[model samples]
Target: MQITKPTFYNEFSCIAGSCPDTCCAGWQIMIDQNSLKKYRHCKGAFRNRLLNDIDWKEHSFRQYQKRCAFLNEDNLCDIYSEAGKDMLCDTCRKYPRHIEEFEGLRELSLSLSCPEAARIFLSHKEKIIFRTVEKETPEETYDDFDYFLFTALMDTRDYLFSVIQDRSVPCALRRRKLLACGHDFQLCLDQNELFQWETIRTRHQNSAFGDSFQKKIFKWKDAEKSSDNLRKSIWKTIIPQMEILRSGWHDYLRDTLTPLYTSCDTEQQYQNVCLEFETFYPDWKIQEEQLLLYWIYTYFCGAIYDEQIFAKVKMAVVCTFMIHELAVGTWLLQQKQFSFPDLVSICYRFSRELEHSDQNLNKLEELLDWEEIFSLGNLLEI
Candidate 1:
């Protein structure tokens, strides 16, 4: 078996009561079967409390206004304090520790969702690196999994990260190349020509198609107001999705953006907004690019097995793009000020809202399939 983690993966330590917001709030905490069983057989006073605290129909801890039942007044987990850390469920114990499992591989990453994890990630001066630990397992079982494709996927992920973290290339170009790679990779997979996949992968990895992609982007960059109508339409479509979040976000979006520029359609005005965004978070573009790369690379190759090519690309693009937009919008709303803590808070909240919710994910996947929306080139105005 092989296990891999990012270099900063081990730097996180949950703040418990000291956090500005607790993870125990703002989401349903689903109890595992084993934890449910353990809680059922308990023979102490706490057992009654546990039984009362859970909503048996949902098999989840009951919440007060979305806050976990186990959450104490001080924002600490009372269950952990009373029953010891060992008694916590798998979900509870493994939070912020995201796992991507494949045949004989378990890739672990510390989710940027945790404030501590975000701190460790953003505080680092160097690029993130993946470290691998490999040892033989006592028994090897067989399945229909493609180990060769998996190996290729891992290599492709590494190469994709290199492109993303390459500061020499502009973020716009990096994104263009990444999306093109996904589009081409899909073609190969669709034709059942797995052997020819390496050739296409190498072309992108070695900048073989990068020059043409760059030319297209440069051409589009000079065009004025060509993307205005597109941006407005997309903004209109996406704003509705934010209804799942706190109310007033729609007004917040318009108030912060519309007055500043009069319209999202104006090219120079949008450029100015981008400039303002850069000023507020100077390295936000690079950070956003890196994050997009991380997510795309991690999920892209595995998506081959499921053959959901466009959905994977859409997931990566939408996540990174929306995150950048929200961060920019939120900072502007706060009078053009933001800090690492605020950025981390936004990252966690966004991911928890989208990635951790099945209803949302399934909806997004369905939306990805619809031809009228979820266009990478259209969304980016490329």
Candidate 2:
């Protein structure tokens, strides 16, 4: 078996009481069957509290006003204090430590929705790197899985990593290259020509291939470079339609977005502000790279399942784009100053609202599929 994770994966440690927000809150904390049995068989005063806390019908913890029943005033888990870590359910124990499983591979990543994890990733100055290791297990068994396509996607993902992490290229051009690659591979995927993925991946990874692909992308994108209707429409029309996990998400968007796109918000004006904002806070290049890497490394390979590879890239692009916009809004709102802490706040809150929810993730994926503005070409309009 093989396991892969980010280099900073070990740096994640839950802040508990000092945490700005509790992971225990805002969503249904589902209990696994094994832990359910543990809770069912426990004895003593804590047992009664467990019985009260556990909603047998839903197999989830009860919540009082959106906060978990076990959450105390100090924002710590009562379950941990009373019964210890062993007594906690799988969801509680493994939280912020998300795993994506395949035939013989386990991809481990710290959920960026957690404040600490977000802070750790963003604070790291160097580029993120994936470390893979082999562990003894059963043979590489994949029943009815397209092992070929999976391997192809691995190559494609490596190609994308090269594109995004090529710091010598301007950040904007690198992002545009991502869209072009997605569109080309998606066309091949549609025509059942994934056999050609090697040629496709190699050309993209080759240094000389960037200029032509970029020229073609420039032809597809609008001439108005400073326009940002894509971000505006997504923020104004799409986001509100998704599941609202936390109470203040809408409010943050309102504060972050409304000011950026007011009644008289012209596209050029909006674009100019964003350009200025990005230019002033040049670190946005790195921050946006980290954010995109977070989404891609986590979801790109999983595309081999349904083969909606474009959708996965689209989701990452849209999410990263909007997060940068949110940062722009945040910068404007904060008298034109944005800091690392502000970024950490935005990253985690956005993840808490979008990444943590199944409904939201599916909804965004579905939207990215059919929405014209989210098209591979249009997304590069930025």
Candidate 3:
């Protein structure tokens, strides 16, 4: 098996008690069956504690005020504090280390939901480089794996990386091309014409209709829409659909967006504040590139199972843009004052809200297909 990860992948180390924003709180921690077995038969001191803490019916830890039952006042895992690291459940032990499994591969990444891991991502300014290391491991087979489509997705992902990492091209163009390619791939899959993938990928790689696509997209973007529309669409549309994990997240969005909604109060004021933000946070482009690549890399190939390739790509595009908009709102809230920690908070908090919940993910992807705001043209305009 081969393990592929970013250069900074191995740099993640949990800050534990030092972390102000602990992952254990605000989300239900599921206890795996294997860990449950261990807990049920546990020895003296910690056994009763585990039994009381574990919600047997739910196979998860009970939460008091949304904080995990095991989370102590210092925001440290009480299980680790008393029972030792080995006693932690699979989820707790591995987080924020996330693993995505394929036939003979395991793609491991540190979740951005952890503020520490978010710092690692935002701090690394260079273009991301993926390094694959071969590791000997047992292989498993799937009942109905779409090997051919998976191969196509793999090859297309490589091409996507090329376009995204090509700093010579503007980030906007990279994003536009990514969504365009995803749409094309999705069409081929829907038509049951997997044979056409090679041709489609090549066409996008060295676009023969470059001039035509530019003209088409340019005209589409020039349609009647303003920055205010983009802001409202991205901000207002997401909140209602999400399973708000924290009340703070609800208040956070309302408070941060007050700039665009109240302080600016006019189209020109909104646009001017946004323009000033570009100058205020010039490295946003770098962060944007990283976030797009992060989402794409993490979830793109997983479409091999469901073959909803376009939805996956749209998700990547939408999420990256959503975070960028949030960054703008946060900056505005601070009266144009932005700092490194602000970026980390925005990235991790968004990850916690969206990525942590399967329901939110499904609702988000479903909306991307039928939502007027997520239409390809609207996304480009945004």
TM-scores of the candidates are: 0.88, 0.95, 0.95
**Candidate 1 wrongly placed segments (more than 4 Å):** 135-143, 208-210, 216-226, 238-265, 380-382
- Per-residue lDDT of candidate 1, residues 12-100 (tens digit): 78888777767787667788999899888877778888889989899999988667889988989988998778768787899878898
lDDT of 1 at 363: 67
lDDT of 2 at 171: 75
Which residue pairs clash in candidate 3? none
Output the worst ten-in-a-row residue range by lDDT, candidate 3: 222-231
RMSD of each: 3.0, 1.9, 1.8
Cα lDDT of model 3 by residue, 1-382, tens digit: 9898888998998888778688887788899999999999999898998899889999999999999988888888888879889989999988998888898778888888899999998788888888899998877888888788888988999888888878887788888888888888998988989899898787776762368778767876736777567758776787798898887788888777766577676677866876788788888878888888888899999998877788889888888877877888888777788988999999999999988998998888788877878777777776
TM-score, structure 1 vs. true: 0.88
- 129 Cα displacement, candidate 2 (Å): 1.2
C-alpha lDDT of residue 365 in model 2 = 79
Which has the better lDDT: candidate 1, or candidate 2? 2
**What's the distance in Å from true for residue 207, model 2?**
6.0
Segments in model 3 whose C-alpha atoms lie over 4 Å from true places:
208-210, 219-222, 225-227, 263-271
